[model samples]
Target: MAEQLLDVIVRKRELQGDGVVVLDLTRADGAALPLFDAGAHVDIHIAPGLVRQYSLCSDPADASVYRLGVLKDPASRGGSAGVHAHLLEGRQVQISAPRNLFPLAEGATRSILLGGGIGITPMIAMAYALEQRGDAFELHYCGRSRNHSAFLAELGSAPFASKVVTHFDDEHGRLDLAAVLGQGRARVHMYTCGPAGFMDWVIDGARQQGYAEDHIHKEYFQAEVDASGEGFEVVAARSGKTVQVAEGQSILQALTAVGIDIPISCEQGVCGSCLCDVLEGEPDHRDVYLTDDEKAGNDQILVCCSRAKSKKLVLDI
Candidate 1:
């Protein structure tokens, strides 16, 4: 909701790797899009009621176009499937201005970029920016295999190719997390994105290596939490209705089940689409949308992935 929606045209589409499709999008009006830094992402409107957030994979310096890589998962809820099936070149699409939550550390002496599977999207942009600035940086990309890895050719030809390392599970055996992050990484700020388990493993390794939390930047493609039933009550102050948020469900689900419609997207918590005002009670802020300071205030919450820490929550719904 921070940026207005714009129409963009899919200029090109190509297979980046197994089940991954790369889309080259440009303004439908042939105008330059908003400038964005590395690690930025745009909310893509799939259907009237379906929207998803995808990281910008192209170089930030290039304002003429924005590139996104999407993984077409067979088990997904149809976001990527729709893109793969219908979002072909020349198709028109709706998107919001790019927003960045996983930005590089401004003061780090060295930078380490870790990517896994389709998570390489943002890392590619970061690599370009870091290389352009002549910063001390290295990129380590991992995947199940070369066939399933996206953008391998691009990474190999990157300006910082010499600093790029590849680790394919089929060939390299499960990543030697400790060895890759063993030493010297303490001085380098790290930025990583991937599947929940993969990112968690990488983050845990960094923490075990004594990396400062502030220097370890991460973004989750999906929420990784036991959102199971811890029964809680929600007091919808606006509607004057009390609802029981059962276990194994989200706050948003509880509201929607009661016919309380809320604007939401990327239920994973990465996008700030489901943000709501909290009139009372403490919120278990789990979403990546809000900053630490914002979470501390407990005045707002992203209902999609957050829950009530207190027994009852008074929401401005």
Candidate 2:
């Protein structure tokens, strides 16, 4: 279905210690919002010039309200800063329907959740889902400090509190990566979301502890593209259109500039909403959203952040 941009009114705002601000929004038209699952996120149209993706931190069953937390990033590309500076209670915003790429698999024996900084957003919702199903799980949250952490109170009071471990880098030194992944548990699936460095540490440490790559899952909140050298061209098969995508302009942006409507959620390439089939040409595949096998098979490409390796490429879109 085509994405519908709905006007959402800010119901409330909460300062979750740290530079994070949680904004709760409800449909301005008072219509029923779409149901979402754990690990789901929505693309919020915060203003005329800004759009950002935030993981839903509220209960999925609470269809009447949508909740999101924004960290005031000083180095932000204007998105988070705009939300914090311009958004307030009772303000109106636009948001897309919920979309999920990091879905929990069914029939898992045990689950382990690791979150860092603001990456705790999706993990928070996963904790709720795991609790409702009475599943065996563990949640490890790491941050520079408790004051810089979001949702500390709710996480502390959650039913899974006993299993939740908080690590403050400032006081407790670096996270005890060895001890956490070395619990020697079998048949346990691990899910993580955090900064690239933190995620790298977790993934690398887990591998060192004999965890299979298939057993480890992760979600990255940011993507850094090194568009230093050159530009490329992308040809749309159906439209018979070719666009010169500069090093700074992503294929998705170029397509959109020419009035092609492509589904996109997280422009960072964490969400798989912008995935499209590649009829021909090699893709640079910079997105973390797709599995290695998926990329090797040339089945799909995340146009939002990925570019082309071939000088000329064709897209099924």
| lDDT per model vs. reference | 0.87, 0.83
Q: How much does candidate 1 score in TM-score?
A: 0.92
Q: Judged by lDDT against the true structure, how good is candidate 2?
A: 0.83
TM-scores of the candidates are 0.92, 0.88
Model 2: per-residue Cα lDDT at residue 8: 88
Model 2 TM:
0.88
Cα lDDT of model 2 by residue, 131-213, tens digit: 88889888898999877888888888877788889899888878888777775356777889888888988998888888877
- The digit string of per-residue lDDT tens for model 1 on 1-317 reads 35579899999999878999999999999999988999999988988887888999999999999999999987777788888988989999899889898888786688888998999899999999998888988889989999888898888887788999999989977878777776645468888999988898999899988888888889877665458548799988888778998887888988998889888877867778788899889999888767788999999998888888799999998
Against the true structure, whose TM-score is highest? 1
Cα lDDT, model 1, residue 4? 78
